[model samples]
Target: MSDDGDDPGRAGTGEPAPAEVGAKWARDRRNRVFLRRALAGVLVVAVVVVLGFSVRTSRLTDESGAFGPDLAPVMDRIAAENAEVEKNHPGAYVTVVAMFPMTGSLTDIGLNRESIRHGLEGIHLAQVWRNRQPSSPPYVRLLVGSDGPDDWEPTVEAIKARTADEHIVAVTGLGASTGTTRRTVESLSGSGYAMVSAVITSDELTGVRGLARVAALNSEQARAGVVHARKVNPGLKAVVIKDLNPADSYVKTLARFYTGSLADRERVMELSFDSSTRFSGTVLDVIAERVCNSGANTVLYAGRSEQLPALMQALSQRDRCVRPGMTVITGDDASEMNRKADLNMWGDTRIRLFYTALAHPAGLTLPGGEVLTAIRARFAGDDPDAFPRVFPHESLGDGMAIVHHDAMFVALETVKAFAREPDVPSPQDMANMLTSGTVAVEGASGPIRIVEGGARQTKEIPILQLNPDGTSAYSGRITMTDGGPGRS
Candidate 1:
């Protein structure tokens, strides 16, 4: 009777004794109290979570909704294509999870949602192409998994959970080159997944097991950028304006490599700023005063394009005592800047600005351009496969499509190269295949020559000049080999 843990049952047969009744009542009361506390705790947590993300989150839970409103059709197309590919190729198709920023501040910078749409569209085109290929067996099945750029740990776990059910062979299109991204790559790598990133450009990301990129590394871009900068600005006395955000791997490597690649006698005053500050407007103004006083003819801006306007504004309004027509060169983050920025609207004091392009449309001239042209034709419905059902041609201009296509192509090529018969290949098998030193992907950007070595896309890195007319002019092309920068 005193034992609350045991059953004091006999309710249907007869009335329980007073002690038994008291015991049952006490146990029931305790259970009710415990449940009530638990429910209250759960409610508290629910409110905290809602309040935490309410300001920042729009719809992170929706698979495609986070890409923005206009991209709903693109998401629908992906779903239809996903269904069609699995339907036609009725076998063990290998899955590749593309981890992109379905939600992030990428747009708060210079990037746009159309770029994300184009990337997914590119992946869809590749799926349709590969599934229909005569090569046969082991067609690709792409699963998108994004928990935003900053919070990828949860999605990594979710993807790991899906591996058995989804037959996931590899991961692709890893989002921005931040510390969070690096950790995700490392975690997925630890779990024996092959990760092919479309746009991860951190120099520090090299040599991580099962991690490869279809984009040029920051050092590669810097190496290529320096080759052009020296020729254009002869004296080349420069101020390196850099972002001090610890999480941003891209700008960190860009600043380091650009500084290292410069001539010993070429350095002037080096300036720094942390983009996280809301006070950038006033801060850049101070930096502008120092630049005017420093006698530097060029500004090697190692920051995202989000801060470009502030720098341009500050540079434009600076005292005319600074060397006129200063040249500003940056990394690949500037590739999409032209779409958001009105470069023509800036004052006359803002001179020439150059940035490295990861994969330019001009890459259509390369050997792989044959494949790119054929695939891109699908976007315009010029190809018989997509005729009268065109995806917008303008979406393909930003190179997201090309890089994302190349990322998927690299993953598929690894699968095809693995010598597997119509069965789900293990991620360890794909990881082994990638690191085996023979997986050369003929990327739409250019040939992705080295996956395991120091550089992934050791092909062409285009240097683009932001024009007064708000367009990018392909100023020059240089290649980055494991050996060094080479002629494209």
Candidate 2:
């Protein structure tokens, strides 16, 4: 058992332990193969993990760059705007009932119907031009109601039915007396729609909670007129007038203020014209000559535009003119005033006249060229009867179109305001917004701002005078002293 080279336990074959050596060699080879395979597998797993992380990072970067800060604000604004549009502009059907005098000589009043429809169409065009923006509800449908020549009863019924249906959002026209327009307005006041009048100038209409006016009130515009008259005739002392009615509110107010403005030492007389007596050219001429010869060079002719041509003709027959130190008259509408002053324009004398025009900046162009051209296009096939040469159809059409342009612009801005607010809007909501808030918008009429009380904030009345060459230009704007028209 203990022999070193060949003990008893060793038999002495001398072949040596080949089997044990072979087994040890096999064990070492197996360990090395296992290590190589494990290293290769780990390398493959690491490569896969790095590639996955890189792909995720790249995707996140792409997403951030595509929808970055620039897009966020725009998206937010659009969503906000659309939310309001959905609330307000639900159906694209807006019913508008237009009431006007359609009988008598005023059958032509409905002739202005084409004008109103064209105005709405123009407004809708402007909106469409705003890059296809979402529009407020009610794609303006107009319904016209007329009574024979000046009867407004039919208009009242139409308005009642329209409002009762709760489909109409706005009403326009009713161009009769203020009383009839008032009835139509009162019927719809509680329905939460707006009432817009074209030429009704009575002051009482403005007090209604839901009505707005495109034409200036005769009572309100009268203020600047008197102030202007005084500016021209600083020493103007008296107004000789034939009062149609002594108790007429218009006559009373005008007389009271005009007399009060003169120097205390000056004497102002109010002459009453006989109601039964129709004034003839010879009579008016005699009166003017007598008045001019008697010391008072300044006279205020307070009458209708129809009477102006006759009055002026009588004065001309007597060699009198509306120049300073002669006679002066103020008129309401441009067409009528320009018509009566037709012959006066042929001469070289300076004539001072005043009328209210829709205020606009010099050189501001409307959507269409020359407002008259646009208005006429609407009547292309409808009414071929052209206006008389003396009517100044271009000027009248331009003026009225400019007014409509301004009103439409205000309405759009109001709609935009509703579109931006968080609350949803109905027609009622829009009317309420107009009552409670104000908006400043650049428009065809001019830079317009609607005040909280629904009155246009600007009092920039246009003042034009005829120069020696008979051309007219803006002299200056007489700022309104108070809210009301001046007394003269």
Candidate 3:
């Protein structure tokens, strides 16, 4: 009983027997090995997860490297084309970048592509007229592409890279979406590149330096919509369907302006849906119930072109809201309502539909009218029906196309004016000149005077109504004096 391994005396001695001590050390060694292996496995998993994320991010944001296709070939083509123009005319060639949304939620209906074609045509026509005198004909090289949606980081990176490497002096063409144009301006403004938008009407961009918009402001459009709604129904009860695309703050802003502009006699019910949401039967039923309960005789859709068709279909199916004398109002995004599919949606509906836009060719009267007529005449020589093709939908007759033309005209004129100086101003200087409100140019949209603070001083927005027979006719015009909303 006194043996060291078995006796209690060993425990009281403050030292274990040799066999017991060896066993205890072995147990501690096994636990340490297990912990080390567990930590190694965790580290391996963490590294793999990080690498996967990095690859995904690289593919999304990196355009210059192998992660995405480089736009160098496109740039080369533009340069080659400009070089040919210079070879014939022998003038100082100035490169202008045209950034279009070729791919995104904005281009779902092919309007962006059509806009690109029209914008390029406008630039080329201006070049031909300006190049008549070989003394200093400006040859414009356009770098065009779609900046991806959401962050548009890929397109922004490509633009920055091209601006640095290609010597781009000015940029145009951000399409109709406010979100796209805002992100684009923010990206290029830092680099001192001047930008012009064809149809971006966000009030938020009013005072942004280095950016000028040719279209009417979103607030102006909303005011026009309210004016037209009240005209159609003196005591209008309206339900507004707002497309809540976080990227496009303009829609929400327009809705707010519309609500605030309403008179005490009028009542407005506001409802919002994300542009990406696909409305199901339950959702549509809820919307229909809301519209019915609100007793709204007019429905205003403030959203993109793609969302309108589904919304119209959903609302039309609800008998309560699809009755006679109901009025539906929309903005320029619905400019293509004459398209085959969209036209059919309004074919038998008893509700009246109207949209607001700049002047149509049929009714456009300004000093710039002659310029557009000349350009259209030249285009007609090649194809008499080119106008219809450019603006296939809506009877507005290439009104949006004319806006694009005006955008190019403004950009070219600005650059040409700067070129006349003894020393060409830097990009920032040119931007300052534009935003200074001193630069007044005759554009297809009429006399475009960029007022101090970047608002284009122009009057006249046409409201086109869709007849029951599926044809659009001019309803009225909204004219702004001193940048305040007034309908004529």
> How many residue pairs clash in each candidate at the backbone level?
0, 14, 1
Cα distance off (Å), candidate 3, residue 151: 9.4
Candidate 1 residue-wise lDDT at 279: 83
Residue 466, candidate 3: C-alpha displacement in angstroms: 4.0
Per residue, candidate 2 scores C-alpha lDDT tens digits across 1-488 of: 00001112213766424233323433443454356557856765787788754211111111212223433332243234334433543333234444444344311231233333333333332332231322222223334445333455545545554452324555555453333345556666766666654445545455566565544544444555556666777765545444343322233343344454445544455544422245544455566566655565555554433344444444444443444435443423332333223345323243344444444322233343222333332223133222222122333232444455445545545544443232224556667766663555554444445556455554445555533232355544544424644322
lDDT winner among the candidates? 1
| lDDT agreement of model 3 with the native | 0.60
Q: Determine which window of 10 residues in candidate 2 has minimal summed lDDT.
A: 1-10
Q: Estimate each model's TM-score.
A: 0.80, 0.57, 0.73
Off by over 4 Å in 1: 1-67, 107-112, 149-151, 319-323, 340-345, 366-381, 384-389, 451-454
**lDDT: worst 10-residue window of model 1:** 1-10
Comparing 1 and 2 on lDDT, the stronger one: 1
Report the lDDT tens digits of candidate 3 across residue range 339-452: 334346543366677888754654444333433444444333344334444334323354655676667767777765553343334567667777778766655555677778
Comparing candidate 1 with candidate 2, which one achieves the higher TM-score?
Answer: 1
